[model samples]
Target chain A: EDKVVQSPLSLVVHEGDTVTLNCSYEVTNFRSLLWYKQEKKAPTFLFMLTSSGIEKKSGRLSSILDKKELSSILNITATQTGDSAIYLCAVDPSSNTGNQFYFGTGTSLTVIP
Target chain B: EPEVTQTPSHQVTQMGQEVILRCVPISNHLYFYWYRQILGQKVEFLVSFYNNEISEKSEIFDDQFSVERPDGSNFTLKIRSTKLEDSAMYFCASSALPQGYRQPQHFGDGTRLSIL
Candidate 1:
């Protein structure tokens, strides 16, 4: 079974502080890693990383995948109160069947002003 | 931006009752999926539908669960019998293609189902 694990299950940081969330996975055929932000309900797409060492960024949020290490990291710099949410990481494996995405438990982040 | 939409923001059903959750995926997207997240738990995939058929389904999707694309716009998931354990937020997602090769899946706000 494909599995994805995330670290620092929960974290609290002051505004403007930088935070890093980690995700590592074990799968048969690795393909891509994705990040998502969830506030109250559904998760919104963040970034998708396919190649190692290449970082994907959006505003204050950035993520990178390390294929050799079988892990990924999401960094939020200059965090604001609006950044408080559950950050999710998911891995998609290369498979003929479409049910290959595995998600981590997620990291709940709280950014206080 | 176009997105996946689900109906009935919240639904409360009694145990052993049948329930149907509906979704409208983004137009031009070729793949559709159903997933659920129990409160405080990780999201779990249930099934994926494409080309008017089921491409794959998880063990969570048993005989009691069925999916259908009755029309061009709407995809539905029907649960034959609900259990208390079934209470969770059900999300509908769609992708132009699998994440590895193409766009990532976009999710709907989700339907919160509560089984009493």
Candidate 2:
């Protein structure tokens, strides 16, 4: 079965600390990988990585995809309490019929001040 | 910036009763999607709609569930018979592209459904 797995289901870090989140997937006809930050009720768009080795960055957050390893990583530098949230990883496979996103369990990060 | 909106922040219904979740996607978006997240569980894809028809659906989207674009701005998900396990946070999302390849999906705040 196609599955997306994320490591360190839960993490606790102090303010100013840096963290790395991992996501690995085994799905057919891979198209792209997306990262979202879910706070409270909504999952906000963070980054979309379609090419291998090229990193997508926004402010203090960045992500990279590795097609060969079938994995990706999200890095957050200078973390703040505002950054605390459940980070979600999703993979969308190339298909002619339609697009369905396979999501991971998500990594819950709590940044303490 | 325009965002997806869902009505009724919470809904409580009895088991076996029917429930309808409403959503208004971004005006220019071409693809619409529905997803549900059980407490402490990952978000699961339910269905995708485009061109006023269902483009694709997941295994979880069985006969009990149905989707429709009733008007130009409204998208609805109807659950024929609610079950205890049906209690979850249902999210509505939209994207400008069909595959959402480079364009990411924008999500709403979500409606929390409770089945008694």
Please tell me which predicted candidate would have the highest DockQ against the true structure: 2
Q: Would candidate 2 be rated incorrect, acceptable, medium or high by CAPRI criteria? A: medium
Q: What is the C-alpha DockQ of each candidate?
A: 0.74, 0.78
Over B1-116, each residue of candidate 1 has an lDDT whose tens digit, in order, gives: 89899998999999999999999999999899999999999999999998999999999999999999999999999999999999999999999976656588999999999999
Clashes of 1: 0
Q: What is the interface RMSD of each candidate, in Å?
A: 1.4, 1.3
Question: Please, what are the lDDT tens digits per residue for candidate 2 over residues A1-113?
Answer: 78899988999999999999999999878889999999998999999889999998999999999999999999999999999999999998885356778999999999999
> What is the Cα-based TM-score of model 1?
0.98
Cα deviation at A43, candidate 2, in Å, is: 0.4
TM-score of chain A of each: 0.96, 0.97
Question: Root-mean-square deviation of each candidate, in angstroms?
Answer: 0.9, 1.0
Candidate 2's residue-wise lDDT over B29-75, tens digit each?
98999999999999999999999999999889999999999999999
Q: Which ten-residue region of model 2 chain A has the weakest summed lDDT?
A: A92-101
